[model samples]
Target: MNTTPAQLPHALVMIRPRSFGSNPQTIGSNTYQQTDEGLAEEEMNEQARKEYDDMVAALKKADITVLSFDDRTDPVCPDAIFPNNWFSTHPDGTLALYPMMAKNRRTERRQDIVDYLEAHYELKQVVNFAPFEKGSRFLEGTGSMVFDHTHGIAYACRSPRTQQEVFYKACETLGYKGILFEARDEGGRLIYHTNVMMWIGSNIAALCLEAIPEKQRNEVLTSLEASGREILLLTQKQVNSFAGNMLEVSDPEGSPHVVMSAAAWASLDSKQQELIKSQAHPLPLSLDHIEKYSGGSARCMMAGIHLPLKPGATP
Candidate 1:
């Protein structure tokens, strides 16, 4: 049997947003969001599509499997390009669906995608956490919590989008240890997503330690050290540039590739770049329009597909 590494997935699921733009509903907590006054809505959508296509092509060219889906037009999900927030797959055949902070984003959890995955993969259990939204508790999949699958740890920052109780419940459900912390951006607003401030790869962990409170930094630092990962410290400015928002994927030959935005790559200094290069090949995509409108980068656009394939299923 062929198996993928726990920390790195060889396949990803991505959604191409047709009506892609900055989501007004998410603007309150997502300080990183900004609208492009220069481009009209149609132009913005066209640019986003182009960027999305280019990213998918690049990932596929690198020998990583990409399952692409088109976004629905009826409800008009502006932030649909970032599908990582809706659901996550596991090697244990557990498909976890999360409760979203934005009502519009909640609609991104389409039944067709779930059905397709179940047909192609070994989906043993479907753990739906969407019910928690009724109580006003939210946990937006990978956006709310970043999982260190190799160590069974889920690193999360507490915010309106990431509730404490719900995050622990997800950890318990996935059989992971929940390492909850508080992180704030430069303006002292709570970081919207854990993935926006930190990224944990197989052998490397990149994070903006300054975003985390002084008293709470040691736990995250100690945990990363204990996990045997080399830490690449990021500045708050870099985090704002989406430096912390990266995903480490593996090719068919099990070689690592760090997928990030051009802005994110430019934010890194020589030392940080070298450290990342030492661990994985840097694959930066230019997502200028998407980043400006959606406030998400390459990492947020991909949902890693970690489920084992069913009999005779192609990756």
Candidate 2:
């Protein structure tokens, strides 16, 4: 395997859901979300938990450090498993909390997670964008924007959950140049999250160019070209299978691995799989139950830990 780049984090933070199900607040915007008519709510929750455990196990087996936490029931959050939306950590010792569109999702943010990070990592600063929620403006963490930290570029598509003004402000705060564009689904609806249609790694980027408008598509292509990344074009059908919702991470030894769902893996053609394998090792986790109901895949479940470790802190 090749040496891992700065864009690939060595550790991840994942929340195991106790009451996982379809979120009513997010279903409207999230066109990818679907309901399993056969399963009861309780059965769905059990399946989600099992899928979560299986995913964590697969990740750990690949030598990735996973900081796992259980969801709280005090204020029930059905979409709590998708932790990448709430907050993000940076290599510059910065922790940022984002403004969520759904009222129920706002409760996913936990003080304990912040405290634990501060205790173990070198957290130099904390930036909160949650105040924007009061004005009904939102810019979800990694969900709304995909950061190519290696090149200091933030790629985002215009959507209800991703306000342009807030996105630009976030880019300015993080010292990144923002690349904003319009991407719509097949039915002419805006894709809720940018991550669902694109994923950027060290040298490779998978994107669904078909979803983007012709006029604004060139800008995205130009930016990726300027970064010298090899682009992999994905069809809308493949994207619906969660093909673009992939994350590149690394093990402690700096071996790069592309974490994705089994469905995503199956969606890829043989040639595409070969190209991906040449870039990094593919680690596919079975998440049919979780992906079918919640509308998110492997990338959404993991919040990458980019902060540096503190003195004497164990990995």
Candidate 3:
């Protein structure tokens, strides 16, 4: 398989339901848990499941190739739909498994999923990084690191869920340079995932500039400029709506399409919408319940696999 990043022309996105989980990195995860008089645990899980199914149907209607998984098993994995945090695929057909920070989340990784993909798709190599979990070092795959494949740059924000060592190793192994920085929300709380603040597309990037500290903002700006990507800066409010978490995907005809949540689309200003429309067609799906309950939006649920087209190409 061709290992060159540029060779990847397709992406694999997962539809998430039952996405609500008690993630340690989320700002208000505990609030989602069952309370004495609030919603029952089973009810919340059921609602999340319904929302996930609706979002999946929306994506399918948009012509996005989705890989749907069932969650009918025991010890429900609430965050199973957001697979990007646990695994990533490369153009050379290499699959990299990551170590997650949440104990319940670690169970999201299913060998059966890999086996299924291998049975249908052409897989070249599998690299496991789950050993870091034993050492208490975590790096939640593409959720923690956003890759600019065209320029060989991997952007990451430092957080308890993203370890520097693991981030550096991922960059080195993938032949990319790491641009690391710290980001915080208005409350001065660290952003849980890099996807919440920025998303790198083929020739453009949607970013929440206000979330990045003043000290690191210039560096990020310089890097984006150096990479020759157009910057679509978003506000904190828009980021909360999942605007910055949008993903750029291509159709089977090689037409580029930008995928975002309906909340994200509604949050964009007319000018911002025009700017994005000038580049690619916008595909929005409603994931309101998933975002509110899981604290992750459309982009978090999709894991873009940079796999080569043919089986013999290097990834």
Candidate 4:
């Protein structure tokens, strides 16, 4: 990655949910992607499109450029809408492809998508971990870990989708310090992804204290504080509402903004809202239908494009 000051990206890549719905393969771990037998497939797709359009419009209105891609339907990548789980780009023009735990989710990784991105931006390196899928060990990109890029710190909660060995290898390759721990929800099941429990920005962090074990909570807190970051504590209920699934991006004007789903934004109290607002503008998008079946919110829908632009390419 780039050895420069850490900041939110000015561009984002969002995949349209062409074939969106709950996946039986992921239902065991993604508690949020609950299927509704009553809703017709046509109606569900319409609702999903409306939500996706609204979110894209909102992000663009905030002066954040969006590179939108339509999800393919051939084999039906159900969770294709949540693109951040497959790959992530860095400031130094490094692109990392992660190994997904879900058999179906692995299909979400497409070479054409990366080629389309490269057509507009300049990426210096490609870190491929998809080969590790043969061993069954996985690291679901940013979905499995919340990165504090500025401090080179990675906060991840161990789960079926996030293995420690894979996590450490990725961190080691990226030169980040890994802080691994177990985090459980109210039902005592492990939270599938850390982004749903912890979110780290340039100098701010939002985390669910209840998710982390009591013994390990202090260590996480200390690490954040030592990194010179202000904390916004979230409750388990809030985390369930996707409160911790927020992403920070920059407007074309160069101002920082925090983006989240309306459901996630609504879960926060006035105090918590005020604290976050002090750092960046909150772009609360309406994505009710998408969140209902995809098990991901605004952050997961957006894969920030931080790679340096190729010659003659606009930012």
Candidate 5:
């Protein structure tokens, strides 16, 4: 029932201006357009890079510690923005590498990023689940499993991208328990990403409870209540604006900030705004082109690296 680590005192986020055609995992969503109006791969990449640069500048202005990295040619990897899906950093300085669903996405797991992180932060262990890919079983990291780090509980929406066995194994590896649920959109389609439907903050959690089936709604509600989290429920319309896909981060001065896309913020009602501001300052950046083409908002672009606090210091 704990809820502190979920509020990131420090985080590592990525920006994608050249985000198009990068995430092969979204092929099921038909994320790509077949019409000529669709951007060429090169053009999309260029635009994505530019958007990413702009986003980084905005975060820097807020004094957020950002570890930025450009896509490299070493492996021709795609869908790198969802780095949280490929790997997760733990408070104990351990790293967990997940098994990706898409063939192209498997290539996105780069050792170089891990090497860089190790140099800057303390790294104790590296637990990899990529071998599951050999058996065709997948469990995309935060995209599939949402960890309540403070309580050591992992909540995951059932989907093709999230296998139940893999989910259990991940929890076991992390010394946590798993709470599996089924979440569907208004159209009754399974939500593609866990972050799209629910986001856990320090004292608050933004979720689209309407997406849960009647049979499972109470279970989800009970879990949230049990965790001592204040809920900020969103409607179907808000979910479309990426409302639930938000991350609570901190500035270099250690002040809490809620990060989301401008589009998501625009969809919020005054009440929702008040509820969010009660917890942290709102930070909304323009990711129109990036979101329109990538179908991932601000939260998807970030990978929170919860390294241990330094000696005699506050994180």
Candidate 6:
């Protein structure tokens, strides 16, 4: 099995936050985000803007094409900065809209972004899963699951935010095999989103396997191993540091670079750092305020634009 054969997205969609903050609706499932009652609205938006700008600048420096869209504040989507939860694009030119658990987050399905992309790229079809939200069954896009595009595998941790029926439906549509498992935090609470616990790259899968149920551990390991992906196990502390939150993308020169947050990079020991470096150049974005408040890190902010480019064009 050939690992690391360019699973990177050609372009990245980052929704620059206008009103980023801790969302109360997500608190039940997302233990990572806490409502900071003392923080004022203006302060939240300002810090988020600074963090968003810095991350965008760093991604551009690495030669990764980044599209920064301003988030809407009128309807008020507090967690709008994490756009990966709302939609995902595919190389087949299919755009899939996910069913968000939060009512306000459901409002995040913005056609304007799609329209903007259509003006630039080639999109074949749109898959709407938003109707599932009507029945209260939700599956937040890339947040609820991580796709190993090359392997035809979708690894997802079971949570209220991710339902099996919805997962299976999506897998059927995307031609992916759904691998379901239960994962918990240190306090025995379910991990809100699979992306926060693990990430599947072209050649490697990084995750805190200990959090997964023991019964399902072998199955998960077997699946990745069968695909010849090098598994990088993370500790609970590292998971909290957002170590699992990473994405691989090619630079302007076509060199693969792995993007992560400063907090996540700091948690790596010497050996782990070298292993990652061997695969791709490390591009760490400073997003402390964004991570602390939004409960999501680098990977969550990046919505992979997998559509085809124009003739003689590059992302």
Q: Evaluate model 1: give its lDDT.
A: 0.91
lDDT, candidate 6, residue 204? 77
Better of 4 and 5 by lDDT: 4
Model 6, 221-309: lDDT tens digits are 89988988899999989999999889887655567888999999999999899989998889888988888877889999999877777
lDDT of each: 0.91, 0.92, 0.75, 0.86, 0.77, 0.86
Give stretches of model 1 more than 4 Å off. Answer: 1-3
Worst 10 residues of 1 by lDDT: 1-10
lDDT of 3 by residue, 71-175 (tens): 546556777778888888765567889998878788888887787667655678888888898999988998898888777788999888888998998888777
Instruction: Output the better candidate (5/6) by TM-score.
Output: 6
Q: Write the residue-wise lDDT of candidate 1 on 252-310 in tens digits.
A: 67888999999999999999999999999999999988887788888999999888889
Give one digit per residue, the lDDT tens place, for model 4 in 164-281. Answer: 9999999999888999999998899999999988888776888998888899999999999998879999999998899989998877666788999899999999999998888889
TM-score of each: 0.98, 0.97, 0.88, 0.96, 0.91, 0.96
Misplaced by over 4 Å in model 3 are 1-9, 15-37, 309-315
- Residue 292's C-alpha lDDT in candidate 3? 70
Which window of 10 residues has the lowest lDDT sum in candidate 5?
A: 29-38
Query: 73 in model 5: Cα distance from truth in Å?
Result: 2.3
Q: What does candidate 3 score on TM?
A: 0.88
Error of 2 at 298 (Å): 0.7
Q: Which of 2 and 3 is ahead in lDDT?
A: 2
C-alpha displacement of 178 in model 3, angstroms?
0.7
Q: Report the lDDT tens digits of candidate 2 across residue range 116-159.
A: 98999989999999999999999999999999999999999999
